[model samples]
Target chain A: MGHVDHNTAREQLETIRTLMDRASTYRRALAPAMTAVGLIGTLAGLAAPFVIRDNARSFAFYWLAVGLAGACTAFLLMRRQAFAAGEPFWTPPARRVASALMPALFAGTAVVGPLVNIHQEGAMIAVALPPLWLVLYGCSVHSAGFFMPRGMRLFGWGFVIAGLLSALAAANPHQIEPSIRMAHTVMTATFGGGHLAYGLYLHWTEKKPTA
Target chain B: MNPEPFPHLDRVIHEKARLAIISSLSATPSLTYTDLRNLLVMTDGNLTSHLRILQEAGLVALSKSTGETRPQTTYTLTDIGRNAFTQYLGHLEQIVAQFRKTTPSA
Candidate 1:
């Protein structure tokens, strides 16, 4: 006879592994759609100047204003999600970074975005946001790994990867980059909507059993 | 013929080593690797191996830090793990009480 009773321990461990697998599956499915959205947002934010104004100087100021506003929208939206769980997602260090980094990043980047039409700095900073987020997401997970659901931990890591790609794509363009805007689509799809999708799938459906 | 659910938590917990680790950590919030090994009266390898298994299962996580001086490692349980452990203890108590009541010698 075997010395160890592997059956019970194996079954319990399997349950957790199952949850993480489902979460990863859900995010992978959603990633492309999100990338598309961010691309669209970037294009829209980029094109807003052509719609409202044409000259470089006027466009820069107007684009900066709108970018600031869009970034503001993103911040507020993130805050709502963070607060909804009674501040569950924001670890103390994460909160500290987000408080200082988000506003400063967005505000600074908005000024830079329209400038991207004429200058490379805007694209550089935009590129930085997603990866910076990725590093932050990893730390957040590794720190809260204990209390978080298995699904949530995987989700955190996924966003980190997605964020890095988005940042890389965003920062590379010299003038009016379409790819980073697409990156936003990717980020939103994977991190924002992808999270909601994973939650909904687990909440609404019973997972099929696996051996 | 008889059929009922098997025990939720059995005498497995009354074992001194596992119980000490679970109960002590429950009060302390989080514990370092050394702290756990010391409390459970286990050797370093014994605790490390168990903690690794727990972490891989997502029941626990270990953190490593390297500051100016040396490295540090710590472990803590996740929400699901904590809940399950708590419920297991409660269910075990109930089972014990039920058996105590029905025993013929009592």
Candidate 2:
């Protein structure tokens, strides 16, 4: 038993608070991944019209494939970063990020099935997919943002708002025609352009990783 | 001087390094040895010693896995540890309250 003073107790309490925050905080080395994803997205957007043309199903599959590729690229980049840092790839925070992302991404993929089935409104469906996917992707990112940097949450919200605005534009035939090309443009602008801009911003602001 | 003025304070968790270890573990589900070391900026010998002490006291648990490169060690707070920490926090709050009660207004 020792004589503990009020000041000592308060200092210990502060130590606990600080340590808890340090332990839980996750710093994601996101610049490279975002840049790579942005490049992939931008390229995919450019190629979509030429490759897929007006076939609604083809358009859907093409973008899905692009999304998958982008996701795989991001995962590999992150894994590489973890390796460089001499840390495990699947840490607690990584698990938390994955868990948070799963539901919304799952919903986005699931919705594509029913959407592609509507044959009569094929053009409308094609146009609709981008916005729906955007919102869902936004939601997934936003959910995962809890375990990531604060900027990530803002990025997620950007996706969500873009999706909503895209949806609104799609609904109004006067504002923008509902076509596969238009859909491609929208995806290109948001997924492609948005990621590139953010990637550039991160590159400028974030500390460069040591070689 | 009063003997054991703060009776509820956990001596095992009272040390600076040990308290820091416990607090870090309390926030997350688990942390690797490297992660904990990096967060606390403690030497390998110091962290190993403190972790050993906490483990002996049934306040922490460790796991080892053979990863791609080497054997990685991870640590987490035990049920006893979590309960102890919660009680420790309650005691600290009480101490602060007691101090406020005795002191006159500024």
DockQ of 1: 0.03
- Expressed as tens digits, the lDDT of each residue in B1-106 for candidate 1 is 0112134443333334444555555544456564465445588787766666566656676677552334547666678558756775554444444445566463
**Where does model 2 exceed 4 Å of error?**
A1-22, A25-28, A84-86, A207-211, B1-7, B11-18, B37-83, B95-106
Best by lDDT: 2
All candidates: TM-score: 0.32, 0.77
Candidate 2 lDDT over A24-100, as tens digits, reads 76665789999999999999999887777587888888888998999999999999887765567887788888999
How far in Å is the alpha carbon of A19 misplaced in model 1?
18
Tens-digit lDDT track of model 2 for B46-79: 9999999999999999998776665778898999
Output the number of the DockQ-best candidate.
Answer: 2
RMSD of each: 17.1, 4.4
CAPRI docking class of candidate 2: acceptable
Predicted candidate 1 versus true structure: per-residue lDDT over A171-201, tens digit per residue: 5566446434443444445544554465456
User: In model 2, what are the clashing residue pairs, if there are any?
Assistant: none
